[model samples]
Target chain A: MTTASAEKTAENGAGEEGYNFAYLDEQTKRMIRRCILKAVAVPGYQVPFGGREMPLPYGWGTGGMQVTASIIGHDDTLKVIDQGADDTTNAVNIRRFFARTAAVDTTEVTAEASIVQTRHRVPEDPMTEGQILVYQVPQPEPLRKLEPREIECRKMHAYKEYGLMQVSLYEDIARFGEIATSYSYPVMVNDRYLMSPTPIPKFDNPKMHDFPALQLFGAGREKRIYAIPPFTKVKSLDFDDHPFEVQQWEENCALCGAEDTFLDEVILDDRGGKMYVCSDSHYCARRRAEGHRGTLSDSAAAAYAAAVGAADRPSEDGESAEWVT
Target chain B: MAAMATLAGSAPGGIDTTDLKPGLADPVHDSQRVFRALLEAMARPGRPLQLEEGLDPPFPLDPATAAAVLTLCDHDTPLWIDWIADTPPVRAYFSFHCGCPLVERSQQAAFGLVSDAENMPRLGLFAQGLDKYPDRSATLVLQVPSLSEGLAVQLSGPGIDGRETLRAAGLPDWFWNDWRLNAAQFPLGVDIIMTSGRALVGLPRSIAAEG
Candidate 1:
C-alpha cells in the first residue's frame, strides 16, 4: 500500500497508531484542561498556561487545536472552518488530521458539529447550547498593542482600568470618523476584560453577545487561554454618539445570492474582475440547496443537486476525504 | 512477599472493593463526557445539569462530586475537604483514584470539598488567589442537598442572560451574603461547583446572586 492510501481515513476506526488520543498526551491535556477551567471561571480573562509544541506551526490554529484536542470526546462530531469556508485547504487538512488522529467523525455542516474549531470567522449558522466554539487566537490580550508590558496589562485587568482601550478607539474615531478596526475588533467580555475576538470581522462581533454556545479562545504562541461562557455579554467598544456599527455590503453572494451574510470579495480574474460571496461557504451551500442562485451559478436545480448530493458526505462510500463544501 | 501477594484491586479493608470500581469505567472517554457536562455547567451558572451517574462513593459523598474529582483532580492539585469528606473511606478513595494531596487548610488548596455546606468555611478562607493571577484561586466542590428545589435566588452577571432564577436547597441563610462579598472581591475569589446526587451547578466568580 502507498503512504497516501495508508493515511486515508474512511470512518471512525482507530486513528494513527502511534499517537495518543487526539494527539495530546494525558498530562498535557490535563494542564490545558486546568487552564481551560480557569479560563471559563474568569470569563475573557487570559489565563497563562504552559504552551506545548504542536505538529503544526504556532499561528496556524495550534492553540485552537490544543483546546479542541483537550475537550473532544469519543462521541463528538468535529468541524473545522478557516474563514468560514469548509472547502479551503487549511480547513480540509485540519479536519483530515483530526479524523486520522482522534478517529472522530467530522462534518462541514455548522449545526451538526459538536465542536467547531475556527479561524478568522464564526459560522453563519446560529450556535445553540451544547456546541463548543474554539477560536484560533494570535494574541489573547486586547491591550497588548497599546501597552506591550504583560505586568501592566495584568494590573489594568486587575484594577478594571480599560480606559486605554477606549482611548485608542477614540483615536480611531477621530481619524476615520468611526471605529476603523475591521477585524480582531476589541470587545468587552461580561463588561469586564477587554478581549480580542480572534481576528474575526467586526460583523461577527455581535454574534458573540448573548450567544448560547460556549466560546473558547486559545493563543498557543502567547501561552494563554480565555473563554466567554454562554449567554455572556460581549460588547464591542464604541462611543454612545458614534455607537458600534457592523460592516454592511450592498452586494449579495455571487454563488448563492445571500444578501445578509458576511461577504468575501473574490478576484474573478486579472482584468479588474471581482465578485462578492458569502464568507460562510457552508451557509452559502445550504442556500443554494434551498434554491437560491446568483449570476455565477448555473441554475437553481443544478445548484441544489450539486449541494445536497452524494458529494456532501463522501466518506459513506469510502473514498476521498476531501471536503465537498 | 506476603504484603505483595495480598490483593490486586483493593486493600485489606478498602472502601472500593475493586480497583477499577473506584474511578470512571473508561478514563479517556468518561473524563471527556464529564468535562463536557462540567463545561456546560460552568458556562450556564444557574442551570443544573446531570453531571454523572451510577457512581458509588463513600458515605456523604455525592456522585457528581466524585465524577468531578476523578476527572479534574491529579497529584498536582491540592484538595481541602470538610469533615464529611474526611472519613477513612473517602480518603482511601481519593488516594486510589485521584492521588491528590488532601490539605488541611483551605487557603493552600487549589480545590476544596464541602460535604457539609452548612458548616463550610467562609468564602475568604479558601485561596482568593493573588490580584494579578486571579485564576490561581481555589474551586470548591460544594455538596448541597438539591439543586432543583431551594431558595429561589436571582442571578445576574457575566454568564447570565438578563436575570436567571437559581433554586438551590439546603444552603445557609448567609449563603447569598457570603457570595456577594466574594463577588465584591472580583477577579480574586474561589469558584463554587454545587453538587447533589447526580446534578451540579457552577457558580463562577463572574456571577452575582441575591435571594
Candidate 2:
C-alpha cells in the first residue's frame, strides 16, 4: 500500500490538471477550518458546519475526504483505509483521489502518514503527537437513536441530560446479561458530552483516551464536525457492575500468528471450514514478512494473494464474459 | 494581491482607510498551513506553534493573529476590533483583505481582536454563545508580550496531558478571575488565541487554568 513517493508537487499546480488544491476552494476550506477549531475548543461536542458536496457519495468516506481536503497540505503524507485494509476499493480510490487532486505524498505504513483518513477502524499503530486521525462518521449524534428529535437532543446535551442513554444501556444489560453493543460504543468525552465513537469496535475505544494524535470526526450528510484533541479523556459509558468490555476472541490472527490483534473470520469452504485472519491487512503482511506464519499461512498464502489480486482488476471483457463462456 | 481599493472616508465610523496591507502571499496553501497551526494550537492549549506567514497586516495586527483572521474570517463572520486595535489602518486592512463586517459591539462579533490586552473588555462583554449553540461564541485574538515571559499559570484539562504551564504578561488584574467565571459557563464561553511575535497559544473554553 506504500507507493514509492514521487516528486510531483511542482508539476500539478497543487492539484490535478484542472481542480483546485485539495479539491476545496479557499473559502470553503476556511469555513471548515473555523468549524474544526470550534470542535477542538469543545472536545466531543459536535459543531454544525455548512457541509459541501464532495465528488464521492455521502457514505463512502466523503466526510473524511472533506476534512482531509481542508487540512491537507503539499508536504503532508496522506493515507486512507477502509476497515484497516489499504487495498480495499474504498481505500484505494480515496488514496488515488488525494494523490491526483491534492498532489500530496501517499503512504500505507501508518507511522509514515501524517494525516490518516479512516472508516470503520483506527490503525493498530500508536500515532505520534503531531499526527492527525480523521474519522468518517455516519452519525455524529450519540443520542439520536434514543431521542430521535434534534431539538430535544440538543437540549439534553446542553443540560448534560443523558439518562435516556443510560436507560438504553441498562436495557441492553438486562436482556443479554451483559452489554451487547459491540460497535459504535458511546463515550463521555472530557466527562461532559456523550459522543458516538463512529462504529469503530469497542476494542479501539481505549486507544482514543489520552492518545497523542488529534482525532477528528466529520459527518458529511449530517452536516456536523466534532473532535477529540490529543490527550483528552475519553471514557466508555458504563456502570461499575456492568463494566464496558471489548470483544475478545479465542483465536489469534491466523495470518499474523498474533494473540492480540482483531481477527476477521473467513469461510474457507462450504464444508464448515473457517480461518481467522488479521483484519488489518498491512499489519498481517508486515508480520508475515518478519517470518511469522500461522497454522494455514504456508498453505493458503498464494491463494489469498491471488484472490486479493483478482479483486483489484475487473474482468476486462464484461461481467457476462467471465461466466457466460 | 487583490485590487487595493483605498476607500479613504468610506470606512464605518469615519476612519481613514488609505494605508492598507496585503493579507497573505498565497491564499490557498498559506491559509491551509496557517489553519493547521491554529488547529494544533487549539488541540494542545498551552503549546505555542510557529506561525511566521511573512505578513505585515496593519498597525495592530501581528503576523500570527493576522494569519488567523485572514484564514478564518469571511463576510459571513461578523468581526469586532477593540479600541486599541480599531485604528484607521487596521480597519482599512481588514476591509480590503478580509471583507468581514466590523460590528461596533463585542457581543455581535464572531471574531474579535484586542491589541491592548491589559485594558481589554471583560470576558462577559463578548458573545458567550447559547446553551444549544456553543460554537456560535466569539474567538478573541489578542497580541500579548510573550508566551513565556509573563504570568505563568498551570493548565490541566482536555488538551493538556496532565499539567502544562502557560505564561503571558500584560493582562488585566481581573483576567484570571473573569476567566474562572467564564469557565463556569462550561460550553458557553469565548475562546482566546494569544499571539506574540510569530508564535501563538490557544486558550479554548475547555482548559482549566490554575496559578
Candidate 3:
C-alpha cells in the first residue's frame, strides 16, 4: 500500500522532484505517529506498525529513518551515527538522505542535534530534555530467538512468562561461567516488559535507565516500534548472584585518554598489534580538542587526526570523504 | 455573497454558519505542533499539557479536542463521535479539514470523540484490538469540564516516575471503576485523551488508576 502511494506521489511530483517530504506521505506519517503514541503510552511494549520500505535496505537503519522522518521537522537538527561514529558509511548515507529529502540541517555535535538516529551505540554524552533518540532495531522482540513463533511470544508477553529468557541466561552462565550475552542485552522497562535495546553494547545499557531524552526503537524488518519515555525505569535482566556487568578495559582511548567511554579494539596490522580507541568519534574528537592525550605514538595520532579532518569536510559533489573510501 | 447565502439557506435551525469556522490555520506546521503535544501527553500519562494553539470549535467541542481531531484524524482514521458532538457543523468541519470517515459503530472506530464524559459510552464498547496486534485499539478523545481541581485519582504506571495524582472534573464515579478494569486488560484496552479548555491529560491503558 505504501509503495503504491509512494509511486503515485512520485509521479504527481508532490515533494522535491519525485520524493515526498522526508520520503513519506502524510498519511504514512500519521499511521507511524499513532503507532508511536501507543508505543510510548505502554512503555517497552512493542507496537506493530505498517513498516514502509525505504530506499535503503531494511537492516540498515530503515526503521529508525522512518521514525526520524515522521517526527523530525524543518527546524530540527538531525544527527545520524553508526557505532557511535558520525563519519561511518551508514551514518553518512542516512544523514545525506535526510539532508536532501527534508532539507533539514545536519550536525555532528551531539549537544546541538534535536534528533539523534543511532545504530549499535548511544552517545556517551548525556542527552538533555526535549531531545529524541531513535534506535535502529534489527529485532524488537527479546524472546524471538528463544520462541520463534509470534503467537507464542505474544502470549508469553501477555502472561509475563519470561521463563524462557531466564533459562537462556542460566544456560549461558552454566556454559561460560558468566552471562554470555554482551550486546543487544535485554532490559525490563518500567518493570513490566522485557525489551531489546538493539545491538548497543551492554556497556551502554546503564545510560538508558532514567534517561532524560525520549528513546524510540524502530524495527523495520520486525515491523515494530517501542519507546522508553524520559526518566522511565529500565533495568537490565539478571539473576541475584550473576548481576549485570559492562565490559571494561585497562587502557583508555588511544587518542582521547578517556577512561569512561566504551572502547573499540582496533587491529592496526595482521600481527598482534592492537589499540583501544573510543567507539564514539565525537567524544574522542572533543577530548582531543580539549588537549587530552593518550599513549598513542606521534605518527599514529597525526594519521588519526588527518582522517578525522578529512571525514568532517564535504567534497565538492556534496558527499563526505568517508563515503568515497 | 452567493456562497454565503447558499450556506445560510441550508443551515439547520437557523444557526449562523459564519460562527462555525474553526480549523487549522496552517495544516502542516499546526498539525505537527499538536502531534508533538499529544505525544508528550501520552508518554507522560496523567500529566497536564497546556496546548499552545487555542481552537474555537462550536459550543460543545473544547480547544484540546479540536486540536486533537485536527492533528490525529485523517482519511485513514475512522472517527466515531457521541450524539452531543455529532452535530452537522462539527461533522462538516471535521469532514472538510481532516477528511476522516465517520463510523456508525463505536467498535469499528480507530479514534472516538466524546463530548459528554459523564454520560459517555462504556469502556468495553470500543475496539480493544486483538492480543497479537494490541496497537490496533481505539484512542478516545473525551471532553471534560476541567482538567484540574477535581476528584484526585492516583496514577502509577509506565510513564509515572513513582505515583502521580490527577484531578479531572465532570466524570462519573463509575469511571474509575471502569478504568481499573481497563488497565487490567494490559495491551488490549482503549487509551484516553481528556480535553478541558486548552489542556489535555492522557490516560493510557497501561496506567493503574486508583481513587
Q: How many backbone clashes does every candidate have?
A: 0, 0, 0
Of candidates 3 and 2, the better by DockQ:
2
Ranking by lDDT: 2, 3, 1
Model 1 spans with C-alpha error above 4 angstroms: A1-14, A297-325, B1-21
For TM-score, candidate 2 versus 3, the one ahead is 2
- Candidate 1 on B95-149: residue-level lDDT in tens? 6777788899888999899999988888889899888898899998999988888
Highest-TM-score candidate: 2
- Worst lDDT 10-window in candidate 3 chain A: A1-10
Tens digit of lDDT per residue, candidate 2, span A121-146?
98987799979999999998999988
| Each model's chain A TM-score | 0.90, 0.93, 0.92
The residue pairs found clashing in candidate 3 are none
Instruction: Kindly report which residue pairs in candidate 2 clash with one another.
Output: none
Q: How much does each candidate deviate at the interface, measured as C-alpha RMSD after superposition?
A: 1.2, 0.6, 1.8
On the 0 to 100 scale, the lDDT of residue B166 in model 3 is: 92
The residue-by-residue lDDT of candidate 3 on A1-325, one tens digit each, is 0011111223322335666677887788888989999898778889988899899888999999999988877667888889988777788788877777776667778998889999999998989877899999999989999999998999888778898999999999999999989999999987778999999999999999989888999999988999998878899999999999999999988887999999989777789899998999888877877889899985788786566553234331225444321
- What is the CA-based DockQ of model 1? 0.66
List, residue by residue over B74-186, the lDDT tens digit for candidate 2. Answer: 98899999898887788777776778889999999999898889889998999998999999999999888788899889988887889989898889999988888878788
The prediction achieving the highest DockQ against the true structure is: 2
After superposition, the stretches of candidate 2 with alpha carbons farther than 4 Å from their true spots are A1-13, A310-325, B1-17
Model 1 per-residue lDDT at A309: 40
lDDT of 1: 0.82
